[model samples]
Target: MEKLHKPKKVFVPGAISPQFIADSIAKHQSKVNIGAHAIFLGQIRADEKAEGFVTGIEYSAYEEMAEQTFHEIREDAFSKFDLICMHIYHSIGLVPTGEISLFVFVSSGHRRAAFEASEYIVEQIKTKVPIFGKELVGPAGEYIWKENK
Candidate 1:
């Protein structure tokens, strides 16, 4: 059996911050070889429910399984696309409706690979990961289990 690459940490304790994102981008400025970058940020939405309106999302996951799935997704993307860099971060706790819960970044020598890889990574995460969310709604703080649409 071939050895799999060790999984990197993909889960954050809370919402992904704008400053962290900005710093990530700024760090890549030194990589002159990268010509194109694609970024995707998944924000918690204020979707109206029958009981109330969504104020935030409380996220949870099977950490071990999710990490392995993430590693596989990364490997598949690298094999399928000529990517120079890729990152995936997901919130593991409460993230306000306007705050970012997920962040995906991909880079390549050209635009197409970066864009395609970015999309692929996001789609794979949505479909394959074991992450779950509880949508915290309204003033009463009632929550409904969220399903990916």
Candidate 2:
């Protein structure tokens, strides 16, 4: 987490661009305090349902609540680990299957801390955040509500 900074909007309008991820990593190289970084990218999957295969997902969230929940998650992660920086991004609009949606990156002084913190953030976001998504299926455009199983 950056010091003396306002909270950033986490939701992207569509699939997370690859260039954005690359740029983020590149920016961290100048920070000599960070020894290890862990990244987790959650992609939309083309899951086969009874009706057909999932083509895309449209995500929405309770923005005010989700942001607050994310802030708490970040603070907890920092207390539990020696973290230098952390970033979380989730796609908001339509994301095609196989495209990235959620990205969690954690930087720490050691690999262990980075790995654990990154994993923790991803799991907590999935379970705790009030983000809803619809799975648009097949050519017919049938839709189903998406939930973590």
* Per-residue accuracy of model 1 over 50-141 as CA lDDT, tens digit each: 98899999999999999988999988888889988888999998999999999999989999999899989999999999999999998999
RMSD of each: 1.3, 2.3
Scored against the true structure, residue 82 in model 2 reaches a CA lDDT of 88
- Best candidate per lDDT, number? 1
How do the predictions measure up, each by TM-score? Answer: 0.96, 0.94
Model 2, residue 91: C-alpha shift (Å) = 0.7
For all candidates in order, the CA lDDT equals 0.92, 0.89
What pairs collide in candidate 2? 1-85, 1-86
